[model samples]
Target chain A: MIEAVDLERTYKLGDSDVGALRGVSLSVAAGDYVAITGPSGSGKSTLMHVLGALDRPTAGLVRIDGRDVNTLSDGDLAELRNATIGFVFQSFALLARTSAVDNVAMPLLYRGMRKSARRKLAVEALEKVGLAHRLDHRPNQLSGGEQQRVAIARALVGDPKVVFADEPTGNLDTRNGEEVMKLLGALNADAGVAIVLVTHEPDIAAHASRQIQIRDGRIAFDSAAGRDPAAA
Target chain B: MTVLEGFRVALEALRANRLRSLLTMLGVIIGVAAVVLLVGIGGGAKQEVTSQVEGLGSNLVIVVPGKFELGSAPTVSRLQLDDVDAIARVVGDPNAVTASVTSGEVARNGTREMFTSMVGVTETMTTVFDRPVARGQAISATDVDTRRRVAVLGSEAAEELFGDVDPIGRQLTLAGVRLRVIGVYAERGSAFGVSRDGEIHVPVTTAHRILGTERVDALVVKAPSSDRVEELRPKLEQALVDRYPGEEFSAVTQSQILGTIGKILGLLTLVLAAIAAISLLVGGVGVSNIMLVSVRERTREIGLRKALGARQRDVLLQFLIEAVMLTAVGGIIGITIGVGGSLLIDTFSPVPAVITWWSPAMAFAVSAGVGVFFGVAPARRAARLDPVVALRTD
Candidate 1:
């Protein structure tokens, strides 16, 4: 479970202040599938950053599993991010020149796993994402959908409590986007792991069980929706 | 992260940019080689000078009778035979003193006549200077007592005067007197470009009688041992002052020559090393510049590593290790080339180049220190980079 109470984030631009997030508050329970939809500058990404402990809220508290993230030290926050939450970026964000297995194994390296153990775990994670054949292939060598899948496998390798995906299908084609959404959906349903996905496309938002629309740094709409197979 | 992981990452990064790494290392290589080679040449020159000075005899002291004054005429005071006897008495040793009177332009054989430096010395001169007879006998006290015109021909002087003939029983004309050569001295190699074998020797009394001079030009004093020179020098100076009232003379000891030459050569070496260190500084600058560029290019990589739970210290250590590793490798290569170059020069050239053990160690230490010194700014810059900004940099 996560909670935010009246979060505020501001950026200084020369003489004026740019509010990325303004007085926003939301919460999600365990094993929940949530989608955050917004326009280009609607503060969806900023909210996700604060929720994942990457950035601290300016004026309020953010709690993950009942612990105040803002009170944790940088090192403690890093540990939390590494152990309790995983991130999937829109660009895949895999190290460009390294293989998929190495990319997946990177998070475990900081955890002090042995090289052989890291390789085995990374291979298994890749297999879970249906990317076992592409384990040795680098990001540039794989298709867009495969690369996204590798990123997902990396996210899952840590066995995190929650997965945060920011525009996971932004760079993929329609078919690849659908394949990635199905994979995320399966991860949520089968593994019972919570997922907070941020997207701008309505069709992409339709994959989640709950949709939260943000407008101008505030929640515009919060509604539950059933997954429609035909729409997907 | 652990040091092993840092090393792995650094090695991988360096390997990925092979040309840049090699170019960066080139500066350090040249710096180390310059330091080693320059110091080697300096050390070799010092040894050469030391050997040359040592060849003059380790216990011998020379008292020259001249007052050296700047922009003024030198007073050529002659030392007396009593001065040598008095110095010997003051030194508390009977066999420690010998008087020398020198004359130039003494011709021997007509066809082989050459300008020769003829030295007239007491019987103790040969033994004090460690000059042993090579072919025949040395002069006796009887020859000095009788003032006989008996000469000892140095190896070069004998060859110049008598050619292939045996010169032990031959007569040579010196200062218009016919002096029989009683012995041919052994060849003493050249030192400071002065050949001892090019001179002729006879008794002091004989030189005074033949050359029509009563004044001795110098006193060659040999101390009981090398350690006694310091004690004997002031005593001899004081005794001479008492014997010849109102006269001044300088006693030049072997240690003075060694110390003076050592200081001068040491200074020269330090200057050369300082200049070489400038090149090392330039090399360090090169490393810093390249490291800055590398940090900039790898900004995203740094962000990713930090995001993956690498501490700031880990990032700093990784870059620092890369810098030191590059310089250390360069130092090894440079030391090899420098030492090999010195050896090659010594083998093929007239100038002797000696490589000491400390030179290579010093070169490596300086090179590594330079890397650490220059690496600080760039490494700090890389470590202080904001991860969010770096990740957003694409």
Candidate 2:
């Protein structure tokens, strides 16, 4: 349900030009689980940003659910992000001082849900992530793994069609990372939500149904994988 | 977001930084307090002046024979009894007009002596000026017509000469002439800082016989109504001119004095209000600075909200509401302190300090306006923040 053609993103660093993504194109259909594996500075994060409509491409056409992101106004893009896409950062960006439930309710709050209703749905989402008992605990009160779980619950609370997770397991231990990857696999199978995960680890990429290896802003390989897609 | 949600968020944020919020509100508190206190003092002064001036009687007009010059030598002019008579005749009512001859000297009763102003007036003076006798009776028409050496003592004058004893029917020497006290006038408060209670009143003919003067220093006329003073003043002036032919005299109306005093007090209020408004400006600046800091610190929050579908207007409104709320709270506190301060001043100080109804309202309005005025820049900065950049900020 997402498409990109000839995406090029460049940044001006004082007197020099830095091309984050140079002429890359990709597509993913609904209910798909894909992983973009690349080395550091290989443009995977930039591509995910473009796909999620969080940032505009310098020169490209990015269509999500058949709507051109480049042609959308800033407010329209914000609405699109709220309604159709969710993001999970590698840092587990929960509001530092707020409760897990409030963090989960953040996405639904943007959808204009009433406070009580947002709380109810946020509790259910936290239960799905196995954090229901820790709903009132702040991020600081929780461990790194638990914080990441709260972030995952926040991403899924809005029930978006796609989730853009940038290194979702990058900050977790091996065991916690495996558990998180299994959760993503179960979500894809049970809920049929499309997920485009960016990771540098081959083991992490191995858990996706399809893998695209990116090198120097180009797709080096695209292939279907079948290693139980959850065991990595 | 709904207004209630916006307020809740603002309250939570402020509660999270209680010290900063209180510090920010300090400016508004002082500003509103200054507004209220300054206006209250000004209003009190006005009321005090009005009461003192009104006590001199509303229909009373004084005609002095000299030009009133400030910081200059006095140029004296002649005002005769004929001029007073002409003014009385032309006033169309003898009951509304009276003239006085005045002199100042030491009076003695046996070994007791006191410095006193001596006023000589017709028997109709009591009716025209509303000075009724407190003890004994006033000088009769026969006393003025026959030029009898009969005196009426003011309250202070009697007490100074007789030491609380009855001075009525007693003899006192004034200007080397022995006169019997026929009555004691009631106590009249200070006028222009001079004690009217320290004066003595007697017949005009008797005063002329004793002080050796036919010239009247002043003439006091009462108009039938306050509104008629303007209509009667020119006619009275013309009559004096016709009778004297070549002399000059000026009629001073109560309205003119009232207007002049009002203007002076009004200008004083304006000056004080301007000085107080500086505090408001300072408060506004404080609000602006605090809001700027808040916007900077909440950059991530703004980005998150924006990414969650909050419009630019919503973000702008949130900050603006916070600023307004801060100032409004300060204003309420300031008003409370100001009113309390005014009441304390009134209780302890001699000058009357009244808190008018409009002062609090004005203080609140000004403080709120100051909040909005200073809140604009920070609110705009918040609204214009780039969500992508803000989200990515560490």
Candidate 3:
């Protein structure tokens, strides 16, 4: 579960102040599938960053699994990110020149896993993404779609309670994008992991069980199908 | 992350840029090698000098005529035969002392001619220098008393002048005066850059009559033992000082000369080793510079790792290990080449070179130190980078 209360994020660009998040409040219950949709510079990415504990808010509170993220130290935040949340970036931010299995095993490296044990888990994660045969393939060697799958495998290898995908299909073809979306849907349905996806495309947002539209750093619309809107 | 994982990451990064890694290691290699080689040769030279001093016989005290400054030639003082006689009289031993006057001479036998120096000494010179004549007999004390026109040739000088013929009975013209060779010294090798087998020896009285000099160049006194030599130094100095009253001369023991030479050579080696360490510093800077560039290039990767749960200390350790591994590799290569080079020099040249085990070990430690010292800046920079901004970097 995740919660935010009037979250605000302001960045200093040279001499001027640019506010990315302005008084945004939202919550997602356990095992929920939510999509935050917005245009460019609309603060969806900033909200995802704050929720994932990657960046601290300029003001207000962000609690992930009941722990105040802003109150944690940098090390604690990293630990929380490692054990509680997983991120799938738009560009498939897998390490270049590293094999797919090795890249997937990278998160477990921080957990102090042995190489053999990490490799074993990485193989299983890769198998779940239909990349069992491409364990030794590097990012450049894999297709854009395959790379995204590798990134997804890396994210889920740690079995975090929540997954944040920021435009996971941004760089993929339509068919591969559909496949990735189907995989995320399957992960939410079978594993009961909360999935929070940020995207600009309405079609991508439509796959989620709940949709929240953000504008000018504030929640503009919140909808939950077959569920109470107040609970979303 | 574990230290092993950090090392693995560093190794992977370095292997990806093999050429750059080797180039970065070059500075440390040269630095460590220079230090090892210089110190090795220095140690060898000190050993050689020690053996050479020991070869001159134990309990020997050399009194040179003049005040001498380091790195400057000795100035001639009024050191006559009185100083030599006084030393012997003070020591209460008639055969304990001998004086030598050296002069450059042109030695001619038949059509062969050679330019060489001649030393004038009494028969006790053989015992003072531990030199026994290889053939015939040494110049006796009676030769000095009678001023006999007899000469003793060093092995090399004898070989040059007499060829395969017997040199003990042959007559050689020295300064246009004919003197019969009475003895030939055995083969004595060179030491401290001075040739021991190139000089000719004659009686002191004969040399004084021929070369027209009443003053000897230097004096040698033999003490009962080496320990007593130290006790006798002041007595020898006082006796000479009393005789001359105003002249300055130096009475130095053989061990003292060895110690002085050893100290100078040791200091020289240390200075050279230090100069070589500067290159190691430069090498460390090279590592730091390259590591900085690596961090910049891998900003996104760093961000991804942070996102994957790598702590700031993890990033720091990764970069630091990378830098240390570079220097360590360089340090090892340098030590190998340095030891090999010193052994090669020792095998091929007359100049002795001894590679001590500690030199390479110390050099490696310095290289590692250089790595850590220069690596901290870049590692800290890499560690302090924000994961958010780094992830956003293209």
Docking class of 3: medium
- List model 1 lDDT by residue over B1-394, tens digit each: 6778767767878987889999999999998999999899888888988876766567888776544233345567567777877778776765777888888956768667878988988888777788887988788789998998899988999888888999888788988888888998889877646788989998889998987888888887888888877777777777777777787776778657676777788898999989988887888899999999989988987776666665678779989988987888889999998899998887898767899999999999988888888888889898888766776776
Give the C-alpha miss distance for residue B79 in model 3, angstroms: 0.9
Interface RMSD (Å) of model 1? Answer: 1.7
Model 2 lDDT tens row, B270-315: 8988888898889889999999998998888787777666677778
> In order, what DockQ does each candidate have?
0.39, 0.41, 0.77
Comparing 1 with 3 on DockQ, the higher-scoring candidate is 3
Model 3 earns a TM-score of 0.95
TM-score of each: 0.81, 0.81, 0.95
lDDT of 3 at B146: 95
Query: Candidate 1, after superposition: displacement of residue B38 in Å?
Result: 4.2
DockQ of 1: 0.39
At residue A128, candidate 2 shows an lDDT of 97
Rank candidates by DockQ, best first.
3, 2, 1
Output the lDDT of residue B105, model 3.
Answer: 93
User: What is the Cα root-mean-square deviation between model 2 and the actual structure?
Assistant: 5.4
- List the candidate numbers ranked by TM-score, top first: 3, 2, 1
Q: lDDT, candidate 1, residue B70?
A: 31
RMSD of 3: 2.5
Fraction of native A-B contacts kept, per candidate? 0.26, 0.35, 0.72
Interface RMSD of each: 1.7, 2.0, 0.8
